[model samples]
Target: MATLTILKYPDARLRQKSKPVEVFDETLHTFLDDMYETMMDSNGVGLAAIQVGNPLQVLVINIPREDNEQYKEDMLEIINPVFLKQEGEIEWDEGCLSVPNFYESIKRFDEVTIAYNDRYGNEKVLQAQGFLAVAIQHEIDHLNGILFVDKLPILRRKKFEKELKRIQKEQSQ
Candidate 1:
């Protein structure tokens, strides 16, 4: 496994929509392993392929449970994920691996049923709730070229504008 370079905010590649994975092969598996390494190294609960400069519909998510008990064993490696059904609504403070050091209250579906191809290229359908659900949706949005910052309210957006610019400038250097 290798750590992939995560594209930070203002990177044009982050705004580019990802392509679907046509064939899940050894290369795809290697990429997924690298993505997992990248996500763990960055301390992010979830990551999308586009975040690492690969514009492909892939994501990994593993949010720890609050109680720190035996969390669900499902460390999802979803390829070409699709939201089959969604229900209810909740507003949660959301953060992104791409947009660092900023959290905002973004409205998201509280529950979701997703259909995706697993790492082994097996079709699977699953339901996610609470934080896991929110994380899933957030990363999926990245595949569609949408950032959490774009979902922010105007006032909030302006509040972070300077910080965003500063980060971008520093990254370039």
Candidate 2:
């Protein structure tokens, strides 16, 4: 599997909403494999297809187990995932691969239940809490053209925008 380029924030394409995956074929399988590799290579816990320039509702997540600090081989490959339920609330510092080097405390559901189609076209439901729940919600937001920064307070978002501009300018120089 090949690693795909992750689109950084401020890229207009990232603002586009993703369409659902319609076919569960070989191409879809290959794409998911590549996405998984890309996410792992970038040391990201979760990634959305739109982050890699594919406007499809696909996401992969591999939250390392706390006890062993090792990620399970079975990474979550979700297609057309939809939130079935959310309950409780927790505030945690969150980061995104697209918005590199930025973290902000955000409130999110403490528990979430999501329904999704697997790589093999089988429908599945997952219940997640803590970090996993937060990660899933973050990735799903990407599918809807939403970024973690978008959830930030207006003043904080403006501050981040100024910082992002400074970083981009420095890189260009």
Q: Which candidate is the best by lDDT?
A: 2
Clashing pairs in 1: none
Model 2, C-alpha of 134: deviation from truth (Å): 0.3
Worst 10 residues of 2 by lDDT: 65-74
What tens-digit string does per-residue lDDT give for candidate 2 at 1-173?
Answer: 89899999889989989998889999999999999889988888899999999999999999888674546585899899999999999998999999999999999999999999999889999999999899999999999999999999999999999999999999999
**Which parts of model 1 have CA positions greater than 4 angstroms off?**
67-73, 166-173
Report the number of backbone clashes for model 2.
0
* Ten contiguous residues with the weakest lDDT in model 1: 65-74
Taking all chains together, the TM-score of candidate 1 against the true structure is 0.91
lDDT per prediction?
Answer: 0.89, 0.92
Off by over 4 Å in 2: 67-72
Error of 1 at 26 (Å): 0.9
TM-score of each: 0.91, 0.96
